[model samples]
Structure formats: structure tokens, C-alpha cells
Target chain A: MESLLERYRNLVVLLAILVAQIVGLAVQVRRTSAGVNTLDSSDASGVRLIRLWANTVVSPPERLIHSGFGLFAGAWTNYIDLRHVRAQNRDLKQTVDRLRLEEAALLEDARQGQRLEALLGFQEKYIYTTVAAQVYGTSGSDRSHVFYIDKGARDGLKPDMAVITPDGIVGKVRDVFSHTAQVLAVNDTSSGAGVILESTRIRGILRGDVSGRLEVVGILADERIHPGEKVLTAGGDLIFPRGLPVGVVEKVVRDPDRDAFIDVMVRPAAHLERLDEVLVITSTEPRFSPQQQQDLSVSAAEEESVPAAVKDQMKASEIMAEKLPGLIDPNLAPDQQPLHDSSNPNPVVQPPQPLHPDRFSPGSAPDDVPEPDAGSPPDAQPRKPSALPSANGGSTLPGSNSTPEATPQRNL
Target chain B: MALLGADLRRDLEIHRYPLLVYTLVPLTALVLQAWLPRVVGRYDWFDLPLVITIYFALGRRSPIQGTLMGAAMGLFEDALSHNAIGINGIAKTVVGFLAASVGIRIDVENTTVRILLTLGLSLFSSALYLFVNRFLLDLATEWSWLTELLRAVGNALIAVVLFPLLDRLQSRD
Candidate 1:
């Protein structure tokens, strides 16, 4: 028996080691199958002590190296890279000027949308706060598409928080350690999110294929899905906020496995392969932006004063006037302007203060009121008031010809 | 039989390295494996740990030492990765044991033989890794023969550069 044991010692040792590993794998598999889905779990309950220890040992050096690189790069760029600064600054100034005009237009549209949303009592999830994190390392295996971020639980990071870049959504936090966390890239097989096509409004589940490409599943083959359509987060997963840019549809193909379903390939908006810095959305609480809040308050005050029947009869122009009192013609005397009248079905009740005073130039018509084009007819002169009471007792704007029924109402 | 055993023993050349070489080489390989992907962006072709494991296992030419070395390196690699601790451990342990067993029979001093051995073992380790992931743990893995072949070739090319550098670390005594 002793001679046999000695003769087969190498084999015995190999078997023992393999069996030990197999046992550990089995334990982990069991733990994983028993509701410890590591990919989506938002707590440390699914994490192994060994992983914590490994991260602790591995993360510090990576952080140090990343910081060192950042400092060196910063120094080089700040001190030495001045050749294009003046040109870049000029270009940036032009961009800022263009963006300011675009912002004014967008702000008006947003305020209008907010007022309508307030009327419908719709609640929205906003990205309230985010933590900036520098990505320093990856899982090192192509099979596991996860990366380590410098900020972790100590920085108030929790698992399943959405990570994003200015370009688009990246992924969500998978595991959180003391000072570092693992972020599962959106293109990882186990990662998923609720997504909606921006144009057609078709909804689907965004999943990562085996080859690490993003694919939208659960969409029917009959749907007309074209390439280049934007995809946004549906926010049904409760991890990412609604309407965040996800990606664009790259192609649509018939699923070889399922004939009824078509696979929508997506090219991720964020550069998943080359991530340097990411923003971890720490909170997805339903909070309004300051502009939206002011609009809501003004809406609430106006709604309180105006009866429901009167509000229902109010035209879009009247609603606009109520929201933006600055659009009232400065030339009109106080009595000439439409006053609060409960009996008048189309009475325009002005709010106590303009919701957005800066939106309009002082003592002038609102920017949105079109100026008379020199090539147009004499009857096309600029109207005195941005909004006025028509002879038919319905409020009308200077340029808008659409009837109340034709005015588009935003859907939820 | 006595003459045949003597000839086989004479063919087997056991190489030794300083303890630091043994310790730091694997440690550095693991650290670089984790760090380089961030620098280079999803560099899946080059696997430093597997190459180092094959290098040390072939040089040591002892099954027990090779198996233990493979286990330590594999476990550490697994620890650094998001994989379960034992999947790489099992694959690398088997590769280590096999490399050492083959080393005792062949003239591993030949560069061509060393490259071929590294290529074969890298493929074997990758296959075992896939098997353990797919069949054993029911994990989803993207398997491509072309990619695997290219990776094996890449590792072989890396070994061509690395084996010579590692040979310099051998203790002359």
C-alpha cells in the first residue's frame, strides 16, 4: 500500500488540487444560482471575501499609477501644449455663442413641455447627482467585461448605480469595495437594460451578445427598425434614468434562433473600449430642474386661480401667455390687455410674475414672435401683442394659424 | 530497462531560479495582465500569466513543483479577474502538470520546441477555461476558433521574446 501511494504521488496530488478547485467552483456556482446574481445585485451579500481581499490588494497600485499618469499628462498638456490654445479658444467661443442661441430655443421648448407635464401630473426621474470616477484597470479577461473605477463605497458608491459618460451610457456598478468598484460594461453578456428606439418608440431589452456587441432583443420582426435610430434608456430597470442616450441601432437582422424576434445591433454611444473617466449616477431621484420647478409653481398658481372649464377652453396661445407674461405687448395699457374674467370662456389670466423674464428682451416682443419679412405683404406686419383675443372669443398668436383641435398635445 | 532509465534521466535537465525570480515573475505577470488592458484597451490577445506558467513549468521539469506553481499562479490570476477562483486554477494546474511531464521526455532547450509547447499549452488552457466556464459552471462564453488560434499564435510570439529573457534569470550554480 505504501509503495503504491508513493508511486502514484504526482497523480494523487494533481487529483487533489483539481478536486479542491472543482469544489470551490461548485460552491460559487451554487451561491450564484441561489439568488446571488452578482451582475445585478446591489449589495455586498453576493460578493466573496476573497474578491474583496483581491480588490484591496490590486486597486491601490492601479490608483497610484492612474494618478501618476493623470498628473504627468496634465502637466504636459497644461504647460507645453499651447500651440493650438488660441485657435481652440476662438473655436470654443464661437461654439459657445452658437450653443447659447440653441440653449435659449431649447429652454423655451423645455419650459413648454414642463408646463404640459405639470398639467398631466407626470413625474420624471432626473440624474440628481453623480460621482466622477477614473477608470484604472479592467478584469483582464475578455470573457468578463468589467473595469475598476477609482471611487467606491467610501465615496458613497453603491452597486447597480448607473455609470455614464458625456457621450452616452456606459454600464452599472456590479461590486463595490472600500475605495474601488467594478463596473460591468453595457456590452458584457450579463448586463442588460430597458431601451427604447428614439424614432419609432419601439421598446426592447438591451443585452450584450457573446462577442461583446450590444443587441436589442424582445422587439418583433414586423416592426420597422432602421439603422441610425437613436436608442434611449427606458428606465424600467430602475438602474438608469429614463431617456438617457444609450446607443444607435447599427443593424437589424432576423434572429437565427427565433424567427418571430429580430436582433437589433447597437453601436454604443460611449467608447466602451477606451474609457478613461466615467460619471457614476449616485442618485436617480425624481427631482425637477430649477426651471421646471418654477414652471410647475407658476402652473400650480395659475391652475388654482383658473377653473378647469376655463383651462380646458384656453388655447395654446393663451396658455403660452399665462406662462410667459413678458410676451404681453408693452404698448398696451393695463385695461387694453386681457383681464381675469371668470364669465369669459377665453379669458387670459396673467400670472403675478413672468415665469422666465430673461427669455424676452426688455420692452420688446418675445424672441419667438416672428419679425415681418421684408419680402412679405403689408398685412404681414408684426402684431402689437404676441397673443391677442380673436373676434371669435378664442385667443390667437401672431403667426400661428393652427386651430385649438389641431394643436398637438404631448403624450405621456 | 536499467540502460533505458539511465538515458531518460540523463535527457532530463532541471533548471532552477532565484526565489525572487520565481515569486516576482508571476506577480509581475499578473499585475501587468490586470493593468495593461486599461492602457492598451481590451488587449485579449496576450495572456502573460499563462505564458509565465508554461515557461516555469517547462523549465522546472518536476510534476509536483509544476502543478503547485500552476495552482498558485492560476488562483492568483483568478483572484485578479472576475472569474470564480478555481476555474483558472484547474485549467492551469492541468497544463502545468502536463508541461512538466512532457518536459522530462523532450529536449526543451530548442527554441522551436519551446514555442510549440507554449502554443499547445496556451490553447489547452483556453479550452479548459471555456469548458469549466460553459459546462462546469454554466457560464456564457464567446468561443471563436479563429480568435483562439490567433491568441495562441500571439502567446507563442510573446514566448519567443519572453523565454529568452526568463532564461537569463536561471541560477548558474
Candidate 2:
């Protein structure tokens, strides 16, 4: 009887953990389902409003916490501050790197805009707007690589809204409430971006898997992609606008097998680990062309002549193209992606399809794994909750780099 | 109000579940010493709720009670913290059990022995908590030997001093 009771006691304890786990997993699933069902844009806006009200209400407590965090950082910095020049140099160095990146991005944007304008024979029009958010807190234990922001639905933020730090793309809005949100970083196993190799016009997909590593896929046989080259979004399909700096190619390994594709690793353009401020581009493409030496005066003169209404209209469309995925497919009931009639560009579009690698999608990876027209993410070996959940149970995870290999389903 | 006496009675009853005295005394002390003040602030760097569970839950004699109670506390804390629902609860329950069972187990009932045991348990549990919570999850964690030592010694002293009073209260009842 005593032994039975002891065994029962152990069972009860185990059951407690099991029950909690079930509840946890259930909540994760329910939230994900909710995310899938809702219109992410409006959801972000609502979240921002809630965040503002809550922020006002909780100012005292929030300030206390913030001050405490600041104090901790301050204490650490105090020691570093003694070496003022070093700190300044570090900040200066980072600033210098940032300015250089912006210079390059600006130059690239100008060139791309020129090409696009020439191709379409349309007047080059660009729009620039941004939303600034101060990162509040992050889920330290979140293997999902999610962070919290002070901005919420009311703050004009919505789920699916892209987030970036000063350096570059930080993440996308995952879930949001009145005054706060969870942003999923590009380093998570799920993020896939349309990237083009700067050196070789070869395009591929940039896959962010568990290891905080990025890879390029879909390079054609004739195109030779090398390491240490730059990778940027081709803005293919405009899921992300073209010209946002992605990362630099770190390694390029050629397989010995005749038909095997090359392996290209990329170091992200932004230093994701220690991130502070970021810019949320409010529109697709830049509003100002590299003011040509000849047109600078004429454009400056004409800039004041444009009516405010036209600017507003341009802002609406620009924001829609850059921020909201709604314009791409207006008819489909949101939450039901397949229900939406997204244009497939071409029935016979050549390479570089940067879509989410969901085998569950109606057309499980199309026949040739569309070679990207430009910057492509390499076909990762296999990954976690986003791409391949099965990999978690299979092969030995790479040591010191246990990046999940495409997990398609995460149980909360 | 759920009747302060009634809550007190419930809490008293709560303390009787096999090995709860050892858990409660230390938890109460640590909460008072380390986490109580942090509760007033929102989003403090240290996770007070996790601290409460780790410091209190595992030190109990009955691992079952420790884990279950820790889980309950975790759930309540999660709601208060406005976290992604059950994340805190789940993490707490796991931490509680591991701390109570495979965690640094000690059987020192004497005041001095209890204090020493409490300190050792606290140190080891905090380290374990850091490992699972920070290292594995990649969340921001500040793992300092001094902080761990301070929390451990502080909690142990409280347990050693408080448990006897609790024992006396139980005897009178």
C-alpha cells in the first residue's frame, strides 16, 4: 500500500507537468491559429492603441523597470565610460559602418529606380516614410527569436509588418495586443527572403534557420556565386522591397557531385544580437531619386508645387505596396491565404521563387523549385518548426550550431 | 476578500502537505528579501516569479507538492506578467521539479544544517535555472557568482530561522 501510494504520488507530479505542457502547447496552437485567421495589418494597429493606453496607465511601474534596466546598463557602461575615447570610437565605428551601408543602399536604390523607370518608361516616383519603435523587452528564452516592442496596434503596427533595426531587417510582427507585440527575427528557422547575389546577378532564396545562419539557394548552373559577396533583396514580388541590404556571402562551397548545387553562407547585414533602434519603412521604394546634379534645382522648385492630396494618395499606395500585403490580393478572405488570388507572376516563371517553404501549401514545392531570378537562399540541409519538423527527430544536430532544420509546425 | 483568516488557514493547510514546510519557509524569506520589492515594478530584469518558484518549490520534502504548487504559482505569475499565456507556468513547473528532485537534495532539519543546506540548494538551483532559462532559451540572463551567492545565503538564513516558528504554529494547532 505504501509503495503504491508512493508510485501514485510520482504519477500525480508527472501528471501536473503533463497537464501544464498540454495547456501550454494548446495556447501556442490557438494563438497561431488566431494569427493565421486575422488580418495582420488591422491587428497591428489595434495592438498599438492598446499599447498606448497601457503605457500611460503603467507609466510609473514601467519607468521604474526601465530605469532599473538603464541603471544596470549604466553600471556596466560606467566602467567602459572611463575609457571615453574607446566608447566614442566604438560608437563612431558603428556609425561609420552604418553611414557606409546607407550610402551603398541609397546608391543601389537610385540605380534600381533608374532601371525600373527606364524599363517601364514611367516617371520615377518614390515615397519614403518610417515608423520608429523602441524595443522594450525580449523573450530571452524564446528559441523562436521573438522580441517585445513598446509600439502596439494603436501605434500603427500590425502582425506581418516588417521590423528593422538601424542596421537592417530585424523581424516581422508575430502577435500584438493593445500596447505591445512579439516580433519574430529573421534569424529564426522560418524566415525566407528573396535575395540576389551582388557580384553575380544570380538570384536565390535566403533562408534563416536555427543556427543564426543564412544560406542561398536556386543558383542556375551557369551562374557562379562566390563567398564574401554581398546579398540583397531583389525586391522580387515586393514581399520585401528591393534594395534592402540582406547580408554578405561568407563561404561558397562547391559540391564534388556533378549536378549538386553550390553552398553559399551569408553573414546578415544587421547585427541582430545587439540591436537598438530600427526603421519601419512606411512605403515601398524611396520617394526621392538620387537628386541628379542637373535636376536638383528643378526638382527642388517643383517639390513645393505638388499638391498635398497627390502626396497623400501616393503615400496610401506606397504604404500599401510596402506595408500591407492586402493590395497584392484584395479578394481573398484574409486568414485564408490560399483563398486569396495572389498572382503567380508567370505560369512558367524561371527560377527564384522565395515563397515560404510549406509542403502543406496546396502545391507542395513546384516541379523545378523555381530558380530565383536574383538573390536566392540556399536549400538548407533541413530545419525546424517552419520547414521540416522531422529533422528535429533525425540526424545529429550540427554541434555548436543546433539551428532547427525547417520546423513546419511548432506545438505552441 | 477570501477572508484573510480563511486564506491563512488555507495557507496553513497548504504548508502541511508532506514536505511543504521546508519549501514555504525558504520561499517566504527569499520573496521578502529579494523578489517582493521587484513585484511593484513592471518588467524588471530579474524574473521574480521564476525566482519565487525556484527558491521555494524545490526545497520541499515532497517533490510532488513542490512541483504542483510551483506550477500554480507559475500560472498566476504568467497572468500577472501578461506573458504569452502558459510560457511562464510551463517553464516554472519544469524548473520546480528539476530543482526539487534531481536538484540539490538535502536533509538538514537542524537550524545551522538547514541554513547551509538552503544556501547550497539555492546556489545550485539558481545555476540550474540559469542553464535552462538562459543558456538553452537564449534569453537575456545575468549569471553572476555574487548574485547567486547572495540570494542563496539570504534564502537559507530565512529558512533556518522561519521553519521553527512554522513548526511551533503547527504544534499549537
For the second chain, the TM-scores of the candidates in order are 0.90, 0.54
Query: What DockQ, between 0 and 1, does each candidate earn?
Result: 0.26, 0.06
B99-153: candidate 1 lDDT, tens digit per residue: 8888777777778988898889989998999989887777767788777788899
Stretches of candidate 2 off by over 4 Å are: A1-127, A221-223, A254-259, A285-412, B1-173
| Clashing residue pairs in candidate 1 (N, C-alpha, C atoms within 3 angstroms) | none
Candidate 1 segments whose C-alpha is farther than 4 A from its true place: A31-47, A60-412, B1-12
lDDT of 1 by residue, A136-197 (tens): 99999898999999999999999999998767899999999999999999999999999988
Model 1 has a DockQ score of 0.26
- Ten-residue region with minimum lDDT total, candidate 1 chain A: A403-412
Best-matching candidate per DockQ: 1
Please give the CA lDDT of all the candidate structures: 0.79, 0.56
